[model samples]
Target: MNEPEEGAAPDEAATRDASAPGGLSRRGLLGLAIGGSVAGLAVGAGAGLAGGVALGRARAAEDAHSAYGFFGEHQAGITTPVQDHLHFASFDMMPRTDREDLISLLQDWSYAASRMAQGLEVSATGAVGGSAEAPPDDTGEALGLPASGLTLTFGFGPGLFENEEGDRYGIAAQRPAGLERLPAFLGDDLDPQASHGDLCIQACADDPQVAVHAIRNLSRIAFGRARLRWSQLGFGKTSRTTTTQATPRNLFGFKDGTANILADDAAALRDHVWVSTQDEPAWLAGGSYLVARKIAMLIETWDRVRLSEQDAIIGRDKGEGAPLSGGDEFTAPDFQGTAIDENSHMSLAHPEHNDGIRILRRGYNYVDGNNDLGRLDAGLFFLSYQRDPAQFVSLQRRLSTDRMNEYIRHVGSGIWAVPAGVKPGSYIGADLFA
Candidate 1:
């Protein structure tokens, strides 16, 4: 990905009616009232933009610090430096929506996404530029905010091609052979509502609101064509994708993804992460498969366990995150030694034991308030990209007997065929549609 261009602040609203035409649903109109305060800022800009030159400098500094280009050989989020916050959403096409609706939705989303990545408004006549009598083209929330290193990655779920309705998009045969829903795994307390969708967009940014803004505006654009199925807000990324990053910790209080694939590791990426041209299905040649698993942690239960037991279960020391075999965090584990448990998470997930197979992990920690039991409803929103879905499947199957399973439950799961990146004039997924 090339360096990102400096852009302006953000804005957008939600849609109410699933069948609302042109995305001007009742909810969207209600947003115009809710955003009245922000709208005032747009009106006052001509007289005196707040902080004026200072704000412009700040935006410029933000661009230098974090922004990433949206167009690339691969989508930005996968190998781009992991951001601090995430807003991941899944959507389903509205009933009776035709191929044209899907196409237009992608076109609109692409245009808006390209603008938002540069920190620009959703359109040239954005938030306050439209006619006074009409609802604004862009929502007014991110008026002065910088791009915040935001990256938008999109994917197509199996249902997008063919669901119970049968080839609704006339592209069922185009679906990759490996794009089917993930097979059921042990310890899965799956929630039907959160598991799968026709489409998904992963928005990652240094600013939480910026990420949320991207999803909100995109959803509004989909008002009549598609509707959100479920979304997740996450912070404190659990993994790193570049060498400059330090290993981050998970909700489990252990350093996670210590040996994750680095962005510069071309050989590993080719062998494991990105789909190749020689692979089946030409449209997804430069793309890869994505698998998401919402793993809920038993916080109270794990917190009460002895420190020694925790260390044994994870096969690493909590303080320095070193392998129990007596080496630093990055040292290759001596699986031959008796120090680490055979069923430990580290041992089970290590590439050495899995025929050198690896997946690029970009997980995040999430907390969704508290449950009725007064316990925290939180865990890891695990995300991984691989050359083929089977790479993840093989690794996950080996984890069936993982020691960590006792303290976590897989509540949601999904698999998507992420397409190759878009060119300047084309929309995402254009190759498959063609």
Candidate 2:
């Protein structure tokens, strides 16, 4: 029944089972199977290729239904396994709002985020349950969808504490000293509209729609208390936080984050990623600093270059992602060997050369359509969590002479002081307000 007619158009045959007279379309059949309305019926049989494709899709659907808890010792998205999609938004508090408004906004956001993380609606009176005469609490796009492993992580920017208008929140003194604007880099061509905010929320999930929905609902909840400043949508995560996952390639076609800090490495997280009581203003004790960089890759130019030069710039073989000097992808790089370029990306960013400094990376590749020049306005959305802003600044400075710098430009940048995880009864950032 799944096979096509003896002689139908190649496209139509693959898309529909035309041999079955007056039967349901191929899409209709698959929809019923995925929705579990037709459990007995086989979805993709007879055709080997089609069966494999259907099986792969079924696995993805199952993965999307998974959920993550919102309230924890630390935010889930930081060390949580990296999700495939990202909807990261920056926001600024309203000018006339006071301390109470900021506090209330965090409370409202926390409530909704906690519920949504469990695959529930923003409110009990969600999309359909709300009064017909009034607006629905939820937007309804994710009504039938699972939580998709959604995780919401919030942060406070430098402006959140004390902007040009002065300390409106009355907690300016609690701001971490390291939570300031990122300094200028060697090849910066930043866009003011896409950079900086008073507050930021990072929504990540396996499904793109779920990630977008999380951000959309949060923005609606903000209403008059805060307004969206800038946002970036990213797909195809460039890094993984777990050992089970394979190393994902970046837009540059190199296996990125091969030596990234894993979630299970508590020592590394303490030394490099998480904040400590000994370090600073005390309110942000269990928190971490987040650095977001919109690194625009010049793909057109990079693609035209020869493979060997490309490998040289990245400091790894294109095929196995192994160091040019030696062994496999996971092997420790031999910096002493002359085979690897001294200015290559690996050498400069490696902890060996940078006083054993490391940052937990959670980056993703993004494509924002195309620019007016008929060029792709796409690149890697580089995100890193560190113990201090200085850690990232130091590493980025060391990469000033990176050979890969010629093929990329840093366009958007921001840094935020991410507070510790939210306690069950208390709201996010309640420590600072206390």
Candidate 3:
């Protein structure tokens, strides 16, 4: 649910249907079915249209700070590919004041989100105010719990805020890593003086039903811990749309999810995340991470690329994110590997290509169907959370330039100032942004 420093994550490497035991385990279930299963995730199928209308007044008058929740590790276990019982869910939270009530409300939300993720539609609409009532048509359907193939996930947007920590968040931090492998961006620890942002939790379930519940439930926990406000948002598993394809199909059609970065576990952190090389935030010690990016793709321009040429430019198989230069999915490109046309693994095709630019990409793929223009439309809701977006932006300006630049375009963009973890009632970024 949470946007990565870059964008969306991949479905393949993502655990879609596996469950690990205890806190350190993978999400219960993960992965999304490519075929009919897509239909099963009727994301907008709910009375969302109706809920919008019904909850209008109540939502307008509801006490923004009166509701909240928080509960971590009450149950501990990591599940991956959470089956179809899973779906990505998140809240468009609004900052509020009252922390205690907000926490309790989140407790209810946690239970609600958790239960719903398991295929139990606790309420007609997961709305915050007057729309809380379950509609009549949703009776059987809303009440029905998803069985098999469910995966759930969630995210806390910038809107979420707490008292003690301000904007600072809480998450277990790991030490700095991969300095020797310095990405083209900073070459060294970029955030030599920054701290980890506040808490951000993620979960995946197999079944779409389960995914929704998992996200909502976890969201509740977040609310309980801090005085917060929220609203549900997001879609099912993300894939390419037609407008985004080489021929204008699927989100920017250049074969999606290929550039994603996957860190298998705590060990992979150093290689993927970033940390300060010198004395930094003592509390931030051992905590090294990146707020990749959120760069919107220009699908219309991206569709102009000829299919075969697309493959050659990225120097990897287009369908899968393998390097054309050589290597399997997730394998670091052999910068020295032979190129399709005597090119280097990380060399820029554009005249502006610069070896000095290197960025760790952890973005996701998205398809926001045809816009009002009726032009085939789609693009990445790209996000790459990095120690410094500057590094990524600099490198991307170069990468986005190569021959591939014509195919994709930078349409929407945003940057968030993230911080380190904090104790309950604590705010984030108190020392810095605050």
Candidate 4:
């Protein structure tokens, strides 16, 4: 984690008062200070100013309604109640960057992320208060908006420890044994441009604007130190981490994550989700491995298929989302049943077939506009967390014969070592350098 810099706010409490009545909220003031425009009010002079102040207070109030704590035992996005929107990004460290520069960048990023998660500006001075000649510290697009329960989770890719040129960061020796590139899968049509990165950030939120705003500001902070390799904007969460959340449907109109590991399942999380010190290079004790796959659904072809064929392919009832063998959404699949196809997605992906193994899935459906032929360029952006990446490898290899592969193409992929969460004064990844 990055050290708290000179201008960084020490804690969320030091940032701004969420209950204050009629002053410009920190975000509003920061936005106005930056280049954001205030609407011209029709009211008289004093009323106009009061109206502006009220607007700021209202914005703060909305933000306070759904804020997530930034500092915790583990990162928020992974186990935090699944958010409605996602902005996932991958970045490559600039050439010749060293350890100190990388540490400074992480520190700066942590500072900014902490403040933003609490609905505060990146810094106390913010955009307007700095030097006039210099560019504003914040981009200011999220000025009047609430934090929207935003969570920022960071990760280190394999390339971060040792690049093609060599171990440029010197910390390659500390790389966890589980941190390595994923092997090519059977039907992977992976795009190199979107495949790998030195670093990644998964920002999820209840509001789309808030999610995008967080990534935009973070990308700005990384300006010279790193450059964006690929980014994905996703909506309509395809999984439920908490039991309270109802299972969400993917773009295929089927309920996804029916058998996913719930956040409240402590035993499941410890056994399958979190990495232990015994399994790693000490710093990654409470960390997790993230496997991201940009799977593009062949919507046109899938739509043309008969409903029964589609149901057989997924091994679930389209309306009720139950296993073809019978019972409700949560019922275990009876793979032995003749009705359930042996090559179906449910049969192949079930824990019974993969050595009783399961990973925590937090995926989202994405539609990236149209393809050259005008069909929807969209599918499930699959994101899963596991204690060891080998678990995923094992499970995915078993899924090689899945019938659902016909309707999807693996277009982009990445795997990263998500470090354990930070303490009060520490920044993300701080343990690595320790």
Candidate 5:
């Protein structure tokens, strides 16, 4: 987030209500300076703004960002009033790299994210739309974009700080709050309610470090998204050894995101995605659809278990997402008989693709450190996309106690009800209950 012209301390109430760019309430901004003293948050802000941080500004040059609105506004229903132009738009990006064919890769990334944005509905930020008109085509299949330099995924995280309201961090605060620490009970949420997720989708990558760079670039766009949270790493769930797919590769060694965004079929695109429209504000529309998650894995403890037992927990081969008995990674499980072979990855036991939770999984992998020991400290920032959170929340909840529950945890979570879009001349929060 950019700095506020004025200064003040952090305020949760203001951020929750006026967190949007040009959306942060002026009244709250003024109160920040005064309240900072009362609440014990004082770094001598710019005089009147609470949302911006003075310290962060003074820090070394970080990635610059520009948050707009969710572009596919006309296609869906918005959840707030529009003080500015409205549409399903938050942030989009060009690739970031010094690699060969980087420009082409960047364009491809933009195209992919933009195409996906077409089907998305207006969400947080200063958007304009409020319907389900956003599009649903994958970058790999739809735009034929390669992961070499393109960011197949784009994302942010749940509020990592105490004062954060959605994606708006206290850019004005001299001292930012919260660390990038994964919560303990952050997994087990299978299907999310209207506003809860914990997923981070990723496949395998030849150069995990390169993937980190790509994610950072994509994160710059997400960081600009005034409505979404940002994270340093995301968990992946690919059965393969490479990382180019949006389908998440879980730490358990599973193939995720198989049924994510719509296939490259023409008919499916129109039915599932959307584009920005005049009905939305000028800035919205042409924005990407969003999927947020709060997934966690039992890495340390899971590692301690025997491989054979692990297979029983997930009901499949960890390396290929195939049944322990042998089959393709993408094959549907029978999930009928007890068929609990000593090593079979049972559908009744694990819900990787079972439990009927159809989400467009797109998340990331993360590592906290070696935990000062030999074990690798890692997990996922699980996220998923859906037309409606209500339709999926039940699906995920069913997996809360899935057989795999023993392999993961559910530490932190909350859902932000994303709206469709809005055109100019509207105000946000108009639909607090709409």
Candidate 6:
């Protein structure tokens, strides 16, 4: 498989009744009160605006069904329930962007994300009602929609800390030891355009419109500060992060992430996923490193393979997704017999053979239309969160000789240090800047 060109245009909400007992929506109240404060400028105007913002936030916090908390020890998207849709975008800082500009952008992004997470618009002025000459704060597509469990995760790439010439943002010294460029692996036809970025944003939600809207507004916010390097739209989550979620299928038509690290597995998360304060730069505490691989599945080739051969390659029954050596879906695979090949995908990726190392997978399936040769351009966009970059590096190294390599090609790759979650009053990566 050949690496395609870098540029690709990639591609949600609940409805709340405005006429309910409350009469006005929480966001509507906020807009009116805040807008009133600006117009009045009389006694207690400051108090009115503050009270309105606080009240709006309180209402948002109470929305556990549709909103994931923005302020937490770790970011939401990593451990949160895998949403049905995804809009992942990587960006490169503009040529003369300074450290302060980066900080400002992060602050603006964090504030906007917080509001959006609560089913509110990016700004108080919203998509309309702002000055006629100014662009709308929000894109307006997600208007009147519920938050849809929206999550916005941010990460900093190795290039963000330092460039080839030298430290660009003067924060190279603060870079986490685990944040490094991934080594070229076997059978990797990596595309330069989609490979690396200075930063990335992963926006996910149950509603496809919500996911796309989040990224679109965020991109608008990043206008001059940064430009999109690459983006991907994904549907059909391939992994289950929470026990409540059922395992989803990938492009290979097999159940994927049957043995993934669950969000409730606290011990597993601490050991393999979340970065600890003791790991290195304390700023990354509670954060995790993300490894993204654009694995292009040769659908035409795989579809032609015999059924038995496909089963042997994946080591799982296509119908039940149970291991050949297993009894049921959740049953542990018994690698003792001839049931599973030594180089099968399951055997190589299993934690037992990988020194008990497992990563939290939040992958998705993508179909980007037909390729140049008329073959379906589709595959699994593999995303994994790990405590250290080395965890993924070591794991991928073992899979280099796996039998499934022939059916898929690694075309795009990226590694980013996902900083700790934002505090209510702080921006993402604020500790690093401090």
- Using TM-score as the measure, the top candidate is 1
For candidate 1, the clash count comes to 4
Tens-digit lDDT string for candidate 1 (1-434): 76632343322110100111232223333333343432322321122111122222235444544656666678879998999999999999999999988887886677667667766655545676656766675776777787788889999999999999999989998989999999989999999999899999999999999999999888877876789999999999999998899999999899999999999999999999988999989999999999999999999999999999999999999999999999899888898979999999999999888999999999999999999999999999999999999999999999999999999999999989999887755678889888
lDDT of 4: 0.79
- lDDT for 150 in candidate 5 is 17
**Model 3 deviation from native, Cα RMSD in Å:** 14.6
As a TM-score, model 6 comes out at 0.86
lDDT of 2 by residue, 57-89 (tens): 122234323666676678779998899999999
**Candidate 5 error regions (>4 Å):** 1-230, 235-248, 259-262, 265-291, 324-326, 340-357, 372-375, 414-434
Q: How accurate is candidate 1 locally (lDDT)?
A: 0.81
> How accurate locally is residue 213 in candidate 5, as Cα lDDT from 0 to 100?
37
Candidate with better TM-score, 2 vs 3: 2
Candidate models: Cα lDDT each: 0.81, 0.78, 0.32, 0.79, 0.33, 0.78
Q: Runs in model 4 with CA error above 4 Å?
A: 1-65, 131-133
- How many times do residue backbones clash in model 3? 165
- C-alpha TM-scores of all predictions: 0.89, 0.85, 0.47, 0.87, 0.43, 0.86
In model 2, the clashing pairs are none
Q: Pick the candidate with the highest lDDT.
A: 1
Candidate 5 residue 85 C-alpha distance from true site, Å: 32
Kindly report the root-mean-square deviation of model 2 from the true structure over all alpha carbons.
13.5
Residue by residue across 154-271, what tens digits does model 3's lDDT show? 2223324332435323221221222111233311222311212222333333334444445544443343233222122223323221222221122533343333323333333343
